[model samples]
Target: MGATMVEKILSSHALDRQLRAGDVVVASVDFAMVHDGRAGNALKMIEKMNAKALPFAHRAAFVVDHFSPPPNAEAANTHAAMRSFAAAHGARLYDVGSGICHQVLPEGGHFTCGDIVVGTDTHSTTYGAFNALGTGVEGTDLSAVLATGKAWFRVPETIRVELSGRLAPGVWAKDITLHMLRRLGAEGANYRALEYVGSAVEAMAIDDRMTLANHAAELGAKAAILEADAKTEAWLQAHGAAAPRPVRADADAHYAEVIGIDAGSLAPQVARPHHIDQAVSVAEAGTQRIDLALIGTCTNGRLDDLRQAAAVLRGKRIAPGVRMIVTPASRAIYLQALREGLIETLAQAGASVEPAGCGTCVGITGKLIAGDGEVIVSSANRNFKGRLGNPRAQIWIASSATVAASALTGVLTDPRGVAGGDWRVQ
Candidate 1:
């Protein structure tokens, strides 16, 4: 029988030995990424292991993004340690304002298609948008990879998700992913691979695809891969990455389950606080008041996402009582937004623009913490209790356009009801 994409990628990395679901193998990792949140532990593990040197230093990266600008002294110390480790190992290091690790790694041309990359962040699955087999691992596992350049894996079964029809106006990749979460639930695809295909997915831009893959972790996916085409090649080359080595699942590949979705019929989805799977249509969310409207993260902070939000807020102002913040995912994206006047547009709309980084998405920046009886609608991934620095503040997840529209009205307003420019992303 034919193999799924994950099976094929894992088998290729395992010396061309055919692999299937549940097969164990010690494969080589092409790249490893560690951020401030986990780099210290990884460095400590390496020291405890007493390894002579990091054999794969050149294939590794250290990024200080989660707590960029050293929100506190503790976070500053973590940055110091990351710098020391990067210099000692001769590895690449991205400092404050460089962006989230997931965006920084690829933008820095660290990995290419078909490469088996691992990171210390669950959102490492973001790299799967480039047709690479990227998954999350613990610091201990990352330490082993740095020391020996290898790691073990049990190939996961595949869940084939077929997306059909074009996305209606105001309905975008974020909404599609939120719908996936609502259908699959939090642990629905635990330790499994989700392979997305069909017309809707193909029509989506690379930025949109990143949003889909980045949030796959919320559905408990070990890896979420999208089929690559010319757009993938163009995006990699534009980012200075090496020529692509795209891979595809065979026509008759075995799948644990095959699910179909009609993108044309999907509406803007909102995931209630305390859980990502607690999703409902925007209309179903009712006219809930909001105090914060956040519009950036690794999940939806790309240039295109900013454009969509800008399209909604141009020549208008946010509600009188609402607070809006915009953060680009990377320095590159931030610069692009500036050149395109997206920054000024967002700022004029009463939104405070912060440096490009994880910012409030990880709660390390002390920006989006919620107070008692507060509600925040964010264009980010996770919304578990205390995810944004306070358990008392409720967080709702939605698309950037949705967040911007709600910000303009100070409630759970639908983007379709707001006057906006072209909502389609290139």
Candidate 2:
């Protein structure tokens, strides 16, 4: 079959194929995961169906993230529910503070190339990082995965984004992606797999590539993939997955649309919602005071991001009322930051550093209380309504530096003013 990454992955795991739009297939799902935020809902659905989460390798993962270290005994109760269910079901579990689910999956070798996966969270599209045909589903749909180890999908078309050039300082991969989405609108890539290529994409880190794939869903793309390279190989090695069998489309690859983004000339970009496509350049995303600023999540929540925030707050303090919640992506990152004094420096700067978890991003934790507050700078993906504390809150998505600078200044401040050399990921 003439193929793309999506097609190739589906064929490898083909339970069935739907060449036309009206066709539907219930493919065997490889991995089905749920985090604290949605685990309870998924479990309830499974219980209703009188079934276990799943019984297969890489199936039935319970991730304890969303509310880490337990906001209170009530939150602890929620964690208990996940633990009990996972144990009873014989599933692998990553407790809170272990790292966001996305960070932990590859580490545990739960994700692999040519795999078909699904999860409850929207950002689940992120698994495409390893060339897996992955996407998000509603908790009900996810609960079915837990029950039957399968879900349905209508094959999506493809969108090809050919990225070129090395990124300039302060112009990271996230910025380049937001620019494209803003131009295309939130549903720009809806029901399509986005394949990113070019020199800029070739040079990106595995984490950076993951970030691009992470947010492609924001533009309504079903999934994203890159031609696997040395980085993918190295990353897969660490994950204990075999050397990544790189996948790519043929020269005559089919795409519903073709777009080009030159990372070299791009600057920092931000997505202010109501929509992810409502993007603005870092320098042009006019300054606006924020009630709360958060750094971390499955999306930019890694050591590199923490280091950038630390660099911006090396000698600064967060403005009062502008609560800055900094969460490390994983326990390892938290410990490394602790040893490196990044955590200490962040706390000293009036930032509320929490255990590695999701907060203020997914709206389930670290809620803000400002009445009628708008525009919270965060590093998480998808700024949907009621996503972080308030349905009315405006979330301005940007790089870690912008989030930190905004926390320090109480206003959206560009990170361009901050020196980069002084930053260290360690």
Candidate 3:
């Protein structure tokens, strides 16, 4: 049988061997990253390994996010260490406000199509949107790659997710992801690779594609990849990456399972508190009251996402009692939004714009804590208990449009009501 997309990537990166699902291989890493949360630990690991020098330092990156501006002295020290380490080793450092690791790496043109990329953050799967095989690794694993430029992996079996039809107005990639989470459960695709294909996926913009791949981790995916076509080439080139050498799976490639989704049938989906899989249509979620509305994260903090929210909030202010926070994923996205007046629109709507970083999504910075008996609707990924730094406050996950509409009304509101005109980013 022919190899799947992930298998093809692994075999290409491996040494003189044809890798298949279930086969273990030591592959060269094209790019590796460690964020502020894990950089200190990874540095300690490298020291523990007694490495005199970092041979592949140029291929690694250390990002200061999660605690971007240094919430406390401890976080400040961690940032200091990361800066020192990156400078000494000749590695790249994305300082505070640079953005989330996932967003910065791609924007910096660190990796390209068919490359094997790994990061210390779970959402490393986000890079798969570029047709690269990206996955998350522990700090120890990151240290090894930093030292040796190689990491081992077991080729995961592939799951074919075929998409058809287009999403309805105000129904975004986030809604589709939430629908998948509901269908697949939390770990339905555990240790497997998800290969997204078909007309609907091809029609998606790079931002939407990133959103889908980023959330594949919530399905317990080991890696997530999509077809590399003209869109992929243009995005990589625009970001300063080298010319693409895209790869595709054989038509008859073996897959563990094949699941299909009709995007036209999907609606604005909301994942109830403490569980991403507890998803339901916005209408079915009822008019749940919300005290906080967060509109940014690696998952939905791109320029398009901000524009979508701005479209809903233009000439309108958020509810009287609701507090809203809008964070851009990176400085580049932030600047672009500024040029487009998205920042001004959102701010005028009573949404506070924080520095570009993980911000309230990771709960390390930003005064996003929810008080007792309060409810939150966020555009970030993951809504587990205490995910927003408070176990007492409930969190709900939805699309940026949904979050913006809900913030306008102080409850869970379907975005289709007000997000139809001039919402899509051209």
Candidate 4:
């Protein structure tokens, strides 16, 4: 193969050639990172293997994010298991009561760009935001990697995603990603390596870029990567990362398909039941209104996103009938929002603020009543069937701005049209 960017990167660290699909290639793993709930499962898998020694014992990492502080007894058990696992195996851990696994790893300078890393959670793909060939695998796969510093894989074909223009006002990286699933369907990107590019891409922040890549699995993608540049470098530097230069895809990189999107024309998008591709514009999905509004998650939980929500709800209150919920992605974001008074703004607007974790996004903690008593506008990833607490109550997806605006008006409205080039005290 002449090799695309992914191929080049893989080849540079390849242990073999002609590693086709269905063939297990035990390539070296540059890193292995795990999170709270997943680490317990990975620990069980490692025990099953009866492994005595680790290939990269010190390189193994365990991070506690989901229920780290213990929202309940089960969560407490999970946290204890992780800490015990870290201690027993001499594994590195980031249990400083800080951010989620994805946010903390890159911020803590664990894996660098071009490192082929894997984790036990799907969102491990978040590392791809920094141009690492990072992806998620089973706990068993991670256990094998822990034992051998290598894992099996069959090379997946590549799909190119080309963003055509600047996003319109109120449309964020999350909007484009949700809308992409709308067109491509959940299974469309299955078993393929995804490459995202173009101008709209350039305008996105590392957090948003991560949100897009992390959601690739929602479409069944093997892995998704954004072409890295100076912005990526700056983000890594700001987060204290000293990543190596990433290999950029050639201008004419080989892709199974080139998908184009004109982001400037895109409105806030939402996905309906059962599949991510069931997405529609907030206006089209408008009649299916909402009763709850939530902001923040690994997908849309950045400082800028909170500011957008605050901007939209600066002076207004959420509709009396609707209950808005806010959860930041990290303890750092919580402190930042607290200092900025975004938490106060949301609370003042009748919103309920939860801890800094992935609580409501995936219907994990803030699960709703399973019937039609509520509809929601959430800034979470994947609005699939039974995804947001209710298989009956409809859930719409949008940016923090649109979610906030919808929460205020109790109806879906184009926030860009409402706010224009600036945030207003609406």
Model 3: CA > 4 A from native: 366-368, 419-422
lDDT of each: 0.89, 0.76, 0.89, 0.75
After superposition, candidate 2 runs with Cα above 4 Å error? 15-23, 51-54, 71-75, 143-148, 318-322, 369-371, 391-393, 421-426
Residue pairs in clash, model 2: none
Candidate with better lDDT, 1 vs 4: 1
lDDT per residue (tens digit) for residues 64-139 in model 4: 6666456577767777787787787788877745767777677677777777878877777778888888778878
- Model 2: per-residue lDDT, tens digit, 1-426? 367777666655554552432245667788877888787677777667765435552376788888786777777887998888777778888997798887777777776777777877777878887777778876778767766777777777888888888776555667877888878888888788888889987777777777888878778878887777777777788768744656677776566888887778887788877677788886786767788788888888877788788888887778887877888888877898899999998999988877776755666675554346566788887787777668777888888877887787788877776654134322
Candidate 1 displacement at residue 263 in angstroms: 0.9
lDDT of 4 at 166: 81
Candidate 2, residue 409: the lDDT equals: 78
Question: For each predicted model, how many residue pairs clash, with residues at least 3 apart or on different chains?
Answer: 0, 0, 0, 2
Report the error of model 1 at residue 216, Å.
0.3
What TM-scores do the predictions have?
Answer: 0.98, 0.89, 0.98, 0.92
